[model samples]
Target: MKTIDPINTTNPNGFKNQASAALEDTNLQTALQRAKSGFIEKRKKAIHLVDDFEHLKTQAQQAKQSALDNLNHHLALFEKNVVASGGAVHRAKTPAELNQIVLKICQQQNAKLVTKGKSMVSEETHLNAFLEKHGISTAETDLGEYIIQLAKEKPSHIIAPAVHKTRQQVAELFKHNHELGERDLEEIRALVDEARAMLRKAFLLADVGITGANLLVADTGSVAIVTNEGNGDLTATLPKTHIVTASIEKVVANMEDAGKILQVLGRSATGQAMSTYTSFFNGPRRTEDLDGPSAFHVVILDNGRSDILNSKYKDMMRCIKCGACLNHCPVYGAVGGHAYGDVYPGPMGSVLTPLMKGIEQATPLPNASTFCGRCEEVCPMSIPLPELLRQLRNDQATKGLAPKLQSMALGIYGWLARKPRLFQLTMGMFGRVVKLFKVSHILPQETPAPDAPDTFVQQWKKSKQGHSENE
Candidate 1:
């Protein structure tokens, strides 16, 4: 994979330093623990209530795979339907192309400020930077995205972008940024209301609103948005022109297929009956409707996804960003999102960043996980995350991106393992030898200073002693 202005993933010390600093942030730790537990409980209860949860998973997986297999055929159909519904479809092959298409529309419409919902594709393309460069002001309307944007931080969690922010942290952010008086804003609802009031003005005055679709239906050319906050509705509706930035992979065959995915999406993400607002837009506003945008534009970005569609990494395109994987990820729970230093994070990020960006630029990410398959179990799509991760690891090795030490070490082990006698001898001698070390570990990569085994080797030796005596 090719990368633009890549960062050095070769510096092991740099990643260690960054991850260490993240681990030390007590506020982030507390917030993550609280959010993770709360979300897990909510999801478990929601899953129990949904009678067809398992059924939905199967249906959703099949639908997604089928859609992916015939994406080209469906995409063309979607463009036709979009035009038929009075919306323009713009095809962009790269991030720069997508940015320019949106900016050109903004220029034609004389748009000064663009109100935006949480669109990861936009963030991926550095759309905010691009817009600002073109003399257009852009603000994130999603509450979590808004908070992170003000703090100049990337989202750690895909669903709850600001899940790492404590109430106290929020108060400070609001006080420092909004100057919302000296009095405390004790209620979460009050904080939400405050954000709503501010966003209302932006919504009313903005010429164009931008959002990312949860899925796009090829049969009808509809962009489906599932949100609990209801901000998606306002952002996409209140503006004169609504622009959607989505990739080709997010399309499904029809609304029925979309429902299958949506059913599992919230159940696996935050545990809700359904997202409070599940809005579907079949183009721009119709002439008959009293409300809705007059001009609607859909910008489909390919980026690096087309290449993925043709390779082993294509399974990743099935991701709906439900964030279930991140929610249960131990490493993500430890360091939060900032440590990833990219728009996406956690186990999903591990498999994705490398494929989307480049293997060398994101080598540290794949190793960040513990090979825990909790992500796969919770994933409604059943993407087999651990298997894919191992594939990525293999790819890393083939590309000469893995650590040289690890490559050499595994090679030696494999050489011995091929000969049963040699392997057993090595293991016996190794077990006997490690008894003298003050500390023991599988490798140098383990955390907490590689703790010493207090009595493991001795216990094994004693067991052997007992067995010999019995014999």
Candidate 2:
């Protein structure tokens, strides 16, 4: 089997070009349209079934916030418990460190074949590529992840990694890759079965398995994994060694707090009351255990998250990776995730990519929002995404990353606002010019100038005059 090469998928700098290309891709547009409404409606229906979704959101938010407030204590407790349960804990300050640590473990195990469940952190570190470059064979067990892996592409959506792929595209990919020899590939079930059959062999023969954690229970030292498919469980148990890659923010104070977050996580993510498989692995299997990985390792990654904890964007740490914001974001709907050009995409990604990578490297990501407030409205964690995006834009201006023309225009507008009469006079002249020359084309395409007879200032003056006469 051919392995994924080390590819540079983090291209936030090329957002404009990628977004333009995404807009023109007919197949991508079809896939986006098909998945968009289903995700939105499902979340709405699920949330409505609850008596008070707001209360649930509050509880989850509080749980996450409390954990973050005492993050050090919780992480230490988690590590201690893991060690107590016969599991080892490894801390990585950077992505390179994470890859190196995982590589060291793989080398120690003399692993040839490795299987993986869906891990966004691994994607962030590009773990598969790194392992493959070191001559380790990796197989993605998650159906969505497997599809993208076959295509040699990065995940487009957080939960739905292959959301950008159409059914036809997937069939073609399978046909090219799999030697099933003219088996029926038209139906979704057939495709799923094909993937399952292929991965089952990898499951039994795999030397190592890797998965991501939804929440790390600090009290029990448990890694909670939620998945609709049973693949995560299989991936974790089938191999002798199981590795978990997670960020430090994933650690909650206790199982109860983790439960609180899980209540809303399913509703906000996939509209399930509980996912099909919500498994908690405390440690490796004991001697009496029937079936489980013998060796368990938890790799806790910092990767700038510790800095974020102390920063103004600390509110962002509460994100559950639910992708509710992505489903509702109009900007995301229009351009799709590939346009963001990073491991993460959409509202959360826009704010996070800039912060995780440098603001300078991901300058365009922060500016990718419509700021319609839907993302924050639907957020289970109430992350204040628009506010964060605005702050990033402010940072861009502060760092001189914004365009000179845009900065000068905003400066002139700010100066004019200080003198109301002068501002009104300047605006009146500009409005007339815009109307006379039909220069609305110069404005943003999404928000063209309204064809009103008079400006708001002119209308306000007329209303004031009428009130004075009546008095």
Candidate 3:
């Protein structure tokens, strides 16, 4: 296996600092504000239009459950079907193995330039960086992905890779990278056209193309890619060789199962009934085919997912990569994806990251949530995100991965929670100090903190004194 360069998996105890910095970044704030309500409102409108939206969600969940229940069986059947279709399936137990498999395919083809579609699994494994380090130039075809590629950043959102970027920021990135002279790319159409023109050249010249799967069908050995831009079609078709990098959990029983999930995936991710391009590539181009890749390969990675399947975090594997959970999450809307300090972020990432990288490295992620339950509420696949996060926190506590200071604070809080009288007294004193801070203008005067109400003990005592006086 080829040794891939180490990417930043997670920052140790860095979520708070990263979140504070994100809160302060003017550009990020502008982009986030623009996007915060759009996804929420659009999804609301889209889901409302469908009379059976909840039914679709239920069907999707059932399909996912069925797939997971027979994961190994479906994977085996998928591999068999792929081989029967004249395509190859590579099972990688780790990221290193996946990278090596992809690299070996490229090297065998003597690939000099690789054109890529939006593959979050590739991002998860740091595939672009790995390929570039080994001397292969890569081009990102998706407009959002292309922008982020130039910016040298991982995707902030699964569907909208460059959602953190504003039109102005995109204009700057284009002006810096492309040779277009003094063009007004302030408009989205202009920026998109410029990227499309640039990517078209790379698409024709590249030897290999790589994409991620929305779902893999076991019955036909097809890799289904759902995209709005149609760039994924070009990326998969133009190159001589096509490579798909997906996790093992993406496999489904058949095309029917794929359709069941697809119904919910589009509405949940981008508020579309159907994406512009939902292409399925089963194998290499047939002799009668006009166009397609000469070779097709599917690289399925485990990368701690196998461990998750057996553990309490198994529900996470049902995620369809719909950005709905992130869009609906208040914490994600405020701080954006980068603050979580990993490739994945928001509610799903909080649970997935700690499991993938271990609780020690990703201790802050599970604690990043407010337990608002919006993620689970909006998830089309019905994944229980809050429950899974609580599981990670419990695992962390069990392993003693939490900081001593935090442990001490929690210990004190636990003690206070147990003693009713002492807790009431402490709360009364704390409320007075808060009121004092407000009165003296010690805290921010712009936003007044709500003074704590009288404790239960005090209220009870006052009622008793009033009764005694009446008697």
Candidate 4:
């Protein structure tokens, strides 16, 4: 794996520059175009087949809201249940704390190598890099994760980590990394077979396996996970000790609630009616079980989520890690996940990265969108993403985080807008300037002048008047 400074990978202020470069990168653009169509059409078709998709989303949202509202109560119940099932629960308040807990577990087991399923929480804490630094080898079992792991890159998308890599790129990566002599590398089947062959050994040799939970059922103390590739099952069952790292927001009341979210999760994420493997495990292998872990541990991390619960961003907690928002985001399709430079990318990432990484550092992320409501439209949780983004922008401005000149300009504009006559005069002058620039070819011919009679403000006022009349 290539060396990466996980701490400095994201640049909230440099997002514009990163996005600009990504827009110009031909290979990335091609990959994004290829993925964009399939995800959108598949999700759309899947939803069309369900008559109660909206109702399911609403039920899922209510369940998450209920869990979060009484988080302490549910967490205690979940812990009690896990203990009853013979699994230990560990609590971590920060990423460093979470890493240390996992490290201690590995050390106690004398684990030299670890196998991992696709865990976004692990990515958030840079677990792989941390483990490697401590002389422990970790292998990513998911095909996309394995590719990015070999590339030493963080996951760009939540579910599909290596969506940015084309098959040709994967073949090249395999050629560079693996010592295969003139193999069939062009076909995806060949690539999967190659990855499977290589990872089979890692799975067998690993002393511990780690995975993320889709939802933690409080009633049963079981961690439910959905995977199309079944790597998660292998990661959880094949090793001596299994550790599940999950966010606090993943806890739900019961299996019934899990079923409600599961209805939309597969449809919104991969367009499948149900994932290939939807498995639940409460404890280590029982005496009757043939093959399973001897020990089970659950590490729940609060990080910044507790604060978000009482704040305006609480709706974001309803997110199920389904990549529907990413698939529908136009900006995401154009530049791909790396542009955001975080574990979670696309519309969800834009809001989340800032909250998790600090708005001061990730300032550009909230403003990266075109304010299209497609993210909210396709979200399985029905999170009001656009409204949340607007709130973030408002928070940013309230903190005086904007550049001095930009703040001054906005202040001036605010004052002028209060005086309609002056505001109209300024608009007329700006339009004239744009028309002059157009004639001189300074501005693009396609650009619309601000002086147009049907400017946005005018249209808004007209619509407002019509609404008032109807009322």
Q: Which residue window of length 10 is worst by lDDT in model 2?
A: 1-10
Model 1, 1-471: lDDT tens digits are 211111233222234555777677778778988988888788889999978788889998999999999999989988989999999999999999999999999998999989998888997898988998989988889999888777766666788888888987876777778866776678888778888888888888898999998899999989999888888888899989999999999999998998888888888988987888899997877778989999999999998899998998888889998998888888888877767767678888888888887888777787777887888888888888888889988988998988899999999999998986677667655744564452357434442232333334454677899999999
Stretches of candidate 4 off by over 4 Å are 1-10, 439-471
- Model 4, 330-403: lDDT tens digits are 99998788878777788898888888878887888888889989999999888999888888888889998877
Expressed as tens digits, the lDDT of each residue in 1-471 for candidate 3 is 111111254263588877777787788888988997899998999999999899999999999889999999999999999999889999999888999999999999999999999998898888998999999999999988898889877788878988988899899999999987877886888988888889889999999999988899999999999999998889899999999999999999999989999999999998988888899989999999999999999999999998999987888999999989999999998888877877788999898888898788888899988999999999998899999999888888889887789888999989999998889988777766776665555445654345434565786898899999999
TM-score of each: 0.90, 0.94, 0.93, 0.92
Better of 1 and 2 by TM-score: 2
Off by over 4 Å in 3: 1-12, 429-454
lDDT of 2 by residue, 1-471 (tens): 211121364388888877877878888888999999999999999998999999998999999999999999999999999999999999999999999999999999999999999999999898998999999999999999999999988888999999988999999999999987887789999999899999999999999999999999999999999998899999999999999999999999998999999999999999988899999998999989999988999998998999988999989898899999999999889878888888889999999898999999898888888789999999999999999999999999999999999999999999999998888888877876776777777554654355554557877898899999999
Per lDDT, the best of the predicted structures is: 2
Question: Candidate 2: lDDT of 234?
Answer: 93
Off by over 4 Å in 1: 1-14, 440-471
Top candidate by TM-score: 2
Quote the positional error of residue 96 for candidate 3 in Å.
Answer: 0.9
Give the whole-model CA lDDT for all candidates, comma-separated.
0.83, 0.91, 0.88, 0.88
**Pairs with backbone N, CA or C atoms under 3 Å apart (clashes), candidate 4:** none
Residue pairs with backbone overlap in model 3: none
